[model samples]
Target: MPFAGFYAAAPFAWRVSHLASDFAMAWFKGWSQKDQRRSRTVLLSGVAGLAFIGVTMKRVPPGHVGLIEDWRGQLLPGMYDDSGTHWVLPIVQHPVSVRVYPVKKKLVKEFTTKDGKPVEVMLQMKMAPKIYYVPEIYLRFGRDYGRSFLEQEGAIDVNSVVSQHTFDELVGDNADTEDIVDEIVSRIEDAAFFHKIKLRDPNIVFRDPNADDDEGP
Candidate 1:
């Protein structure tokens, strides 16, 4: 979750307001009652403005990008807010933060090898959505785009690739499983690219499904 800018700015606003109030009291001490009340009202209005600004602005943290969406669930085009504080309408517009940093996800699939042995294969991948395509990504997959699209498509590709190789070819000393992993990664990368996700450094490990608790990916 992204932190709202108001929380960090509120304290500063509070201190400024306090200083202004103290100064106002000192300055209005010798003034007429009517004039003092009017001046105090102005001070209070300034404080209220500060509070409103604090509440309306949101912070987009490092390694993340922000999108603006309207109250009617429609994304505003070309409204990308980068890493910084941005002002957005409280009710009419909403700011959405999407992580651009790579996140690690592990996919485990069970399938039969070409030699008919049941095996479990685990694929580990690091991926992140492209910052520029965040709006489109959010529209298609919501916030959980990785799990919704990448993982689903990756699992299908992994199953398809792993089932083509025999158990010996998968686990043999001279086996070129790197090529297999590369193939699966390529396919997944291509699929994820269409959804604006960048897949990186994917690895796969195969293990016997009937074995007793072999647990390292």
Candidate 2:
């Protein structure tokens, strides 16, 4: 009779054990889902915080102009001058530095003068973009106006002017090289004025063709 009673209770005991196991598994699954949600929220919040900081802070150095370009690489209309610190959207916009201070460049070229003699002339000049026309300069020349416009175009103008004068007229005993320099400076200043560039205080030197030379003026 005792053995019979034990067999009858075994099935009931197995059902109770199975129910308890299912309850435990369901509770654990619910707790895991909650943890996953909390982790995701924290990760998204961190990314958003970083993006906000990046957009709010910007710096522009002294003696420079800050030009802003959009993500599509288009320059904005506004110009920033004499800057120390600035603010803009970091990812959507970028800051470009343009030096407003006077920039110097030297040009040395061999030209055949009106008398057919090859003369080497060296010239130096100081130039800068007008403050009020910074935006125009940026629009017309981009970031390399100093080299592309001033140096390259200036060289061509210098050669054209020198070709009109003979070697004797450039450096002879009665030659006033200063007058030539002044003329060249005036022409450059006039040409660049429309483009928002200023040329100042040009100085010219004539190098001896017989001397050993390796570089320009």
State which candidate has the highest TM-score.
1
- Candidate 1 per-residue lDDT over residues 1-217, each given as its tens digit: 1667878888999999999879877899889999988987998899899999999988886777888889999987764456468778998998888778998878776878888888788888788988888889889888777776655788788778878889877766645977887898788888997888988787888877767766556
Q: List the residue pairs that clash in candidate 2.
A: none
Error of 1 at 45 (Å): 1.1
TM-score of each: 0.71, 0.67
Q: Evaluate candidate 1 by giving its C-alpha RMSD to the native, one decimal.
A: 5.9
Per-residue CA lDDT of candidate 2, range 62-167, in tens? 8889888889988787777664566677778888888889988667767677788877777677878888788778777777676667556677777778887878
User: Considering every candidate listed, which one attains the maximal lDDT?
Assistant: 1
